[model samples]
Target: MTPSLSRMIAQAAGRLTFPVKWFTYGRRFRYEQPQKGRGREFFQWDIDILGTDSFAADAEIISIAASFYKKLGLTPQEVKIKINDRKFLQEKLSAMGIDPDLTLPLIKVIDKRSKVTPDNFNTMLTDAGLGTEKVSSLLNILDDKDGYKNSEWLTGILNIIKQYGFDDYVEFDPGIVRGLDYYTRTVFEGWDVKGEFRSIWGGGRYDNLTQDVGASQTIPGVGFAMGDMVMEEVLKKCGKFPALTVNKTRVLVTVFSPELFDKSIELSNILRRENTLTELYPDPRTKLERQLKYAARKGIPYVAIIGPEEMEKGLVTLKNMSNGEQKMLQKEQVVKQLI
Candidate 1:
């Protein structure tokens, strides 16, 4: 099993809590190369707050995930956070007289429901040592729309999430029994609304993880991790990918000719001093047309050309590559105009 981050926190005198890294490897045969979301090796963004067992901690964690979606420009209509409590699921199972040992195996099967056919899923449950009668009851509970409607834990945490104004991005989901024995309460998964992609991310409260690993005491925690692959696909589908640009070059200083190369270099240095992102052409002998084309190709929005004619007047020709507009500006005015 992967070592518990919670245990590490307790040993370190509560030094680290939020934004931990959990590096893990998955089987290549199952997680094939170049797939939309699956891969052989990946890192998970595991955010957690230790030393508190309050449902408020769970609410705060969920709010952080909703805030992240907002940052990515994903509307509630485009994605949602599905929430459930493992304790609630265990309660329902106990009510149906399910053997405690079979709970983990049963959850693992339910976790694969969307991937397998209904018949195969039922067969897997039977193979995992569940009798036909218990399997029927379990399936009914899993299918019940109102299964979690009466859960006080779910109700309380959701009310807190509403106060954070993230209710639109979340809903009660009994089927989300995160496939892990460590998670004791408040499990969740972020899903794409269109259902065309896999889960954007998922996590839950693992109150026992610290003690399970080796700690003498438990630390309650909650967080989620999103993979870059699925997030990129979702952004592309929603047309929310930000416009790409060369980060260091908002303006390109083109070497108009060998004779005027020094002027271009000087102007670039001035722009840099003014806190502008500037790139200077390295080759003085490069053609003006070729240099301008290079600037445009690099997504540089503006270009400064210091040819002999402009140099004599101590002026520079500023061109807006996006609109193909050019104007003559005094050397002193270049900084103000470009800025």
Candidate 2:
């Protein structure tokens, strides 16, 4: 599941990921509750740039997710991109004397605030050994509905996104952690702003992840993961699905009679030679009305009928379904008629 999702994401972004890291990680597994898009065993998308740390890297990842949603037909209004920096979260946690490691799990818990009651969340904080002061401060930061109270880090990130021309779909959200232990910088999430699902796609910076395993130097990188289920739901709900169709095949050759089957095949070959899509009716037992009706219903624009008379004249009768028009046509003339 993970490899499939990882490959899909790579293709969407016109990139590829090597599988050597999976072997290095020992192919770990963890359980998650099964729901509409969750499962006990599931896909995880990971991406990084081994040497970049510019805010542009962060913005680029966010834009990458946004572009994916755009391709899926989700309107800009229906999608909202949210970002928060792990550095900023660490600083905020540190200011309250809460150990960032201890607080990291709490961040994952707090991420579920929408699913749990306020009383339950508070009890959770108490159980996690958070003092009343730290709890109060954290709750206040989370509940700051108005814009003025937001910290400068958030404002600066937002400003940079605007400079990058990606602010239209971006928002500063304090609650987006991406829940992993390795995120050390900017994190981004895409929300179906008005939908039932909580998040559509999310990713963040993990400068220390590669180094944690073996690499000596730190590698700063950013990327996100998108779930097909949530994205397809959002796209369908918003009517963004493009038409699923195939190349147009306009001409079908009808088998007028068993004796005339060879003539129909010849006419079809001529149409093909002229570069017009042509189908030779497989069975001569069907009625002319049924065969022609099949062509019309299947969106074939032209049907060629070569009976004994037309075969004698070295011509065919081209039936245009659009206006119920029919004309005797030479093999050279059928291509222009269909086109």
- RMSD in angstroms, all models? 4.3, 6.5
lDDT of 2 by residue, 2-98 (tens): 3333333343333434321221112224476667755454444444343466666666566666665666666668889877776777777787888
Instruction: Compose the digit string of candidate 1's lDDT tens values, residues 76-179.
Output: 99999998888899888888888888888888888888777899999998998888998898889887867666888888899999999999999887788888
Residue 197 accuracy (lDDT) in model 1: 81
Q: What lDDT score is found at residue 236 in candidate 1?
A: 92
Q: List the global CA lDDT of all models.
A: 0.81, 0.70
The residue ranges of model 2 lying beyond 4 angstroms of the native Cα positions read 1-51, 68-73, 144-160, 163-165, 212-219, 239-293, 304-317, 329-339
- In candidate 2 the C-alpha lDDT for residue 7 amounts to 39
Residue 169 in candidate 1, Cα distance off native in Å: 1.7
Candidate 1, residue 82: how far the Cα is off, in Å: 1.0
Q: Which ten residues in a row have the lowest lDDT in candidate 2?
A: 19-28
